[model samples]
Target: MHPDGFAADLARKPDVLGRLADTLRAGNPWAPVVPPGIGRVVLIGMGSSAYAGGVAAARMRAQGLVATSELASSPLLPAWGPDTLVVATSATGGSVETLDALRRLPAGLTTVALTNTADSAVTESCGAVVELAAERENGGVACRSYQHTLALLIALELHLAGQDITSLVASIEMAAEASAHLLDTETTWRPQAADLLLGPSGMHLAAPAHRFCSAQQGALMVREGPRRSAVGCETGDWSHVDVYLTKTTDYRLLVFAGSPWEAQMEEWTTLRGSTVVGVGGTVPGAQFEVRYPGDDADDVRLLAEVLVPELIAARAWQEQF
Candidate 1:
């Protein structure tokens, strides 16, 4: 992937997201294809696509819907049936595993494809298609597509619940504004955030369970773009799994902030003197905190916060050459 192109892809996020917001405001894209009486929902994708699906599935489950996200490559996928709805997500519409998974599904089952390419192979396999509208990523990275995937999945969630899209549209607009703010002010925060979190041992990211995709996608940006070592864990799970690293390594943690468990994480990081970078909100003992226009909203954080590491990753990747 071209680092400069990846950076350019990120620079256009606000515009792309804003256009998506306008598209939603104009029409509900999933209404016609999403059938009624769907008792169960199965979402499948790989990498960042799966990461977005996981959070969307969790949100759907919390609403009392039986929803699950699985790796497209999993051999043990749920049985396909008439009452089940399958959502196959692939930003480029070209994941081999996802295409193979679709091929194995029984005919006459309701399946929807979420992809940026209009007439791709994945779209041909599914009965209905919802274009991500993220445009092509010339960088060959999935930065904007990842963000658009989460936003569209949320839209799908709202549709499945029979909820109004007014609020969601507004939230998308707010997230676009937040993203623009972050990109406009990156010079002030990017350097410090990169310096604080780019330790010899790599980076660690944590976020609340609902917004965990931010952490996952952020870590992926670092590792995928710059070939760095970065791991993402749930904020609460950090105390159990990642806390040990703070004691032994040159640990640098990037907390997405807003988790109720933030205090618990802060208690340990403060004690270990680990470098901490907080995004979207405050962490008591953080070495640096990155905040933006709509930082207070969780939905906004879901759509916008990943830009922090994406920008840092872009900078680091560009520097490597």
Candidate 2:
């Protein structure tokens, strides 16, 4: 096998991350987040398209903005308020739901569109645009594009919110270092292991909506990796009922989180005989833990974890190429 063939499985996230990390050099990290004194920020999208928006919203909220993330098709739209900043994130830039919401935005609302396709409908409807080149064939269920979108939004939030962009960028450097180590060392020989992941039974992944939006899509890549059914659920919620359904027969794959609860969860997963691969800074007890560095290292590791699964999925589908 080619040395980098293993990289196919790891490619999804780092490709996007390289793009995301580059935004540290962006001239306007502190550029206006909104027209002066905005009351709220509405981030809109659907599906993984919405996931990218959620990443942005998380950073906005972390930076202390009254930000809200909603489906592009939310029954409510905020327009009466002057401080409303609408951020539309779409990987394809042609998501039907986002296009519809873009049209619904009232005149004078500031719109920022993040997309891989500059010519798509979402771009046409927005006031400002961040053009990205989505670089996957048939896009692999929206890969690097969404990651870059999240990266851009994260950087933008850190910059504009006056929340210490310098430190954040420093952390991105750390994350990149950690990602390189994982790709070159830990992930180097995991493709064959991926075959073990293939089975009639489903694959179980855990993360809350906070991590799910991005992690779920990346897990789908793993589904492709092993050509099996993969189900993602929130951790504590999964603990309530779903984990009880786990049996020796179920092909469970645990993606460990860095939450304080992660150590306990990781222990539980091992006892159940689930295949565990740990990524991020705090996923203790994982069979394979890749420590990603960042100011919010845990979260950065969470997002970066998606790439490993994507590479695994690419392995399963390699014959098609």
lDDT of the candidates, in the order given: 0.92, 0.62
Tens digits of per-residue lDDT, candidate 2, 46-102, equal 876676676567767867877877898886976656667788888777888888988
Total clashing pairs for each candidate: 0, 5
Candidate 2 ranges with C-alpha deviation above 4 Å: 1-23, 29-33, 78-80, 133-141, 186-189, 192-196, 208-210, 223-227, 263-271, 281-296
Candidate 2 has an lDDT of 0.62
List runs of model 1 lying over 4 Å from the truth: none
**Residue-wise C-alpha lDDT for candidate 1, range 217-238, written one tens digit per residue:** 9999999999999999999999
Q: Ten residues in a row with the worst lDDT in model 2?
A: 1-10
Model 2, residue 209: C-alpha shift (Å): 6.6
Highest lDDT against the true fold, candidate: 1
What pairs collide in candidate 1? none
